[model samples]
Target: MSARVTMKDIAAELGVSINTVHKALTGKAGVSESVRAKVNDKAEEMGYHRNTSASSLRRKDINLVFCLPCASREGAYFYRYLWEGCNRFEQEVIDQGISIERVEFVVGGYADALEHIDERLQVGEKIDGLLAYVPGDDRATHLLEQIAEAGVAIELVDGDRPHFDRLGASLADYSTAGSLMAEQAANLVHASGADARVLLLAGDPYTDSHYLTARAFHNYLRDHNVPWQVEDLTGAHAQVKQLERELKARLSSSEAPELICSVFAVGSELVADTLVSANKAGEVMVIGNDLFPESALALRRGIFTNIVYKDPVGLAYRGAKTLGDYLLWGKTPADPVQKGAVEMVFASNVDRYCKLAGI
Candidate 1:
């Protein structure tokens, strides 16, 4: 049999232990830079190319995969940021000369995501790393474990998973920032009236992180003893219109909600649109989520009083940079990349920071 040009072969050529090769390959905690350089030099001289296929037999790519359980742009209100971020990531990677693949896996239950993983493996599409904007759920956890076992480094971009740190990457804490927006909404209600009821519209379930804002809103209201009802309005435009009518009826009734907080773009825009058409725009205190085009319009028209905007372009730039760093240098992200918060947007800055994205 032809001798395989493996890490072991490189180690043997350098008269070093196999563990040394492992350290050299991973550039892990203890190895000196000089030693790493030497190993790399020797491996190169020995014509040792990393056999990704062979590596998959024992381990898999640690490069990266950006998985969006379900890439539902129209149906998912929060998908705007995810799509924008991933698109930015692709551009950034190409600019940086890194070999990383970003795939939007159809979002399904744990079983479905796992099935996708299996399909990728079957096709011999090796994944060394995965960046996901996943929901916080058991099924997500299981799929994460399976991906880890395959030796792919995983980062949850805008969500949290209990075992994400163990997966050798990191998670951006949207929940923390979401709480801030929620608190703002609470304050809006407080200013409006303590007896004022509220209606919170949530984004799609495509990623749990998107709903973090809603969860935070709920908590804030509960803490303040404010009465509120939450609804999820995700899907087609017709469905959104239907939800708007339902919300309108509730708002128009004698027991109408005084404050409407939208935690998703579609739903928020729907609420705003409904209010405008009903000529009840200024009657209700309105807050919208994610300053997409529609939300921006609503804000400009005075339909939405406040916006909890998330910077999709920033997320994309950072996610791509993180993936590139991991692939090129085997390094991890130093921060969430959004600075002081897991989420940042036009609403957070009085100077209109989102304009930097030119969107």
Candidate 2:
């Protein structure tokens, strides 16, 4: 029978003590290069299977673990930008000598890579740090606490909660972004000279730092004394059609809103398309959140004045880089890093910064 290789066996072969073998194998500081080299050579000669999992409890590997929510195969357009940014950033960091591996976790469903939280821990992995994009406060908070208690480094990207001490990027800066969008919409309204009212289209208040944007819109309308109304369309197309019909009837009876600020992508596309077909494209100012290609072309045709853009790719790239710095170098970031900055994109520069970053 083949013998099981252990630390004692390697130490005996090298004429060293088990303590020396332990420190050398674990990459712990204080072992001299001469002894570490001798012990490593001897262990490799024996075809030893070092218990890396056991060692990882005491020493972490330089790998990044990324956790995200579940999405369909088609996925969302925003996620695509995020994925591209993370891949590019990971490659760049790897070129700088950081070993990185990404692990994606779905919220409730598990496929091959991650079946459950336990599976996330079992995949031949030792994580030096974690990057989480969990969209829910309650769930992300619970998971982040677990990672921190384990001594694994953590960086929160687009999700916000006070449980984490570090942010890879930030999620709270949406209020400023919201305010910017409102101001742009208002500008478009004034450009139309109060000849048109403004219709604020919104969707899914729970997703993507949206509450801040919605609140900002309300504040802007109040402060400017602009006549506007906010509507929530949770993707019921039939209901949206009904609202559109009613809105159109109101336009016939009185005057139409000069601008439409679509706060979320799904409802924005629908609202924008409806208004365009009604021959109101040139008459109204349209602005919305999170640019997709369709919206990009819309801006080119002057269908939209501006887009309140959030760069997801920047979030992931910066998030991973920040976590890597903290875990490997033991460096801390600026305390209370303000929420991330949002950019306003218009017809002139919309094409350049539309892609977002992700896992």
Candidate 3:
């Protein structure tokens, strides 16, 4: 019989140390994704099989930290769903030697939250993995680097920092969602047999998702030769009253847009309400993002033309699951950036979504 292959043999063949091979095989931190993939492929090629009895004896409890926004924070209604999804994942893996600790910060307070985590790591905390929503800022990036250096695997949620050495990310294809909305807008205008002015109300320009969605929306219109004059307003979703006033002003203007596309859920609601208040609900077509109770109601009443659902619950669930599986099973995700499904909901199918969401 052929001799059993070993880590030593695999390491020698791959031109790497046995420690690297061990880290890859055992699904521990410190190995890059590329090296892990190579090590795994070579181990399988050489007929290497782990000693299950020894591995079981050496296994230890995994500690995963979920660093996200507090559900009670301003503009955090979507975060509540993310929290629920993470809790669901934790429950499923409670008996499997894995534990999840949830850490929250107010919206726009990611820098402080991440600094606290960095302090913990500095004090030698044994954090195996982290599922978080990292903001794009210099301080946050530096802290993330330090945490990664301490050998904690990170799986980002909502958005991705491709420059960071994160295990993976779970987020919506925002560009696609935006393009879908743009396509729907084009169809609506085409059916009307006239050129229409369009307004795009986008959220914080610094947010990757919001930026991508707005960019895609504009690009689609330009690429498809859609003869619509588009005016994009950035940072228009920061406050309810502010958005209301802006929408009211736009609605009251003589050159009010024939179509309005809001990439934020609250912005969509405010636009619908303002249009109704101005008695222009029938004069404008509204396209929005997300499927919440208020947005669902607007769809039913024909105040909203269509909505692009980003599926926050699904994104959070997958992010947590990916990090958990990586820590517990030495399994790497199939894609470095995992994208959740985006759905387009209209009045015709809004009831089905409302029933699913229990709204």
Candidate 4:
């Protein structure tokens, strides 16, 4: 027998470092597919098999788990695109013997997600790393901490808050995007040549990303010498009737703000609908988040002055890759705080953005 081939023996035969051998066996990022194939062939030739027993395993294999938010009927499309991104990354590393499991929960169900996590652990499927779409809740944050209490890496996508003591996060630069959107809003207001005030629409106060963007928009409006007012549409995002009622009430006010800025996807859709239905679409300059179907159409028709599009797929792909790098190769992402590229679309460029984004 070849003297019980060890990692050193494999490295010597392949003329590569022991680290490369380890990474290949674990299906980790960093090593190329060709090198991994060479290392695996040699390891198999030496009759070396991976040890996957839960206890005292010499060979470590990574198990990357996912927990994504699944919304109800109305917001399901939003989650559909987010899942598309996650699935794209999932397909890339699926053949490497690393198990990837995705646990889903309802739109705003933190308790459901935690229960599902407990149920998953009961099946003895160990988690080396987790990539999840974080929501705006303190309990869910605590649940994530508990899941990773055993030293598992946690990578957050779409939304991130390192201050909550998370290991890493991949998302778009909301604060900066907000500032850019503000500049666009200012331009639209000035070009309109009216006493247009910004009617800032924001989601729940706890939604850090949306809140940050609203703050930036408000600050920029103040700095640019424009007037603005805020309407808290936090819980009403998924509520159609409530959203319409609130938007209608605000629009019918004595001094209605002609410039509407929606800071979230659902909010944007609702705002777009209200403006179109009221036939005031052209009059009110709308600046908002997301490029969902409604918002895309609204932007295409010049109803939405500017639509800020965040790369959903990029966030998921990068978050999954980050976890793979950390769990498989013991490599931390060079930038732990990764942000997706933000694209700005106007009526003049909506077609190009739509074609590129496949919306």
Q: Which 10 successive residues of model 4 have the least lDDT summed? A: 51-60
List the candidates' TM-scores in order: 0.68, 0.68, 0.83, 0.77
Among all windows of 10 consecutive residues in model 2, the one with the lowest summed lDDT is 106-115
Compose the digit string of candidate 1's lDDT tens values, residues 1-359.
56657776777687764546766776664357888999999888777777655443332224456666344654344555566666766665464444555455443554566558756855767665566664456776776666654445555555455444322323334565567666766677677665556676665544454455666666776786755565544442336666767787887798777778766566776887788888888788787766666676666667777776566546545665665565555555554333323443333352374464344
* Residue 272 accuracy (lDDT) in model 1: 78
**Which residue pairs overlap in candidate 2's backbone?**
81-356, 82-357, 82-358, 83-358, 196-258, 197-257, 197-258, 312-357, 313-356, 313-357
Off by over 4 Å in 4: 1-61, 163-165, 227-234
The TM-score leader among the candidates is 3
Q: How far is 144's C-alpha from truth in model 3 (Å)? A: 1.5
Which model is ahead, 1 or 4, in terms of TM-score?
4
Clashes found in each candidate (C-alpha, N, C closer than 3 A): 9, 10, 0, 1
TM-score-wise, the better of 1 and 3 is: 3
- Candidate 2 stretches with Cα past 4 Å from truth are 1-60, 69-75, 96-99, 103-115, 122-125, 164-169, 224-227, 232-256, 276-280, 336-338, 354-359
Write the residue-wise lDDT of candidate 4 on 170-271 in tens digits: 888887778888888778767778676667777656776678887787777678776555445554355668778878887778877778887788888788
* Global Cα lDDT for candidate 2: 0.62
Model 1, residue 87: distance off in Å is: 3.3
Rank the models by lDDT, top first: 3, 4, 2, 1
Task: Report the C-alpha displacement of residue 268, candidate 4, in angstroms.
Answer: 0.8
lDDT of each: 0.60, 0.62, 0.81, 0.73
Runs in model 1 deviating more than 4 A are 1-64, 69-77, 95-97, 100-102, 105-114, 135-140, 164-178, 186-195, 202-207, 221-242, 334-354
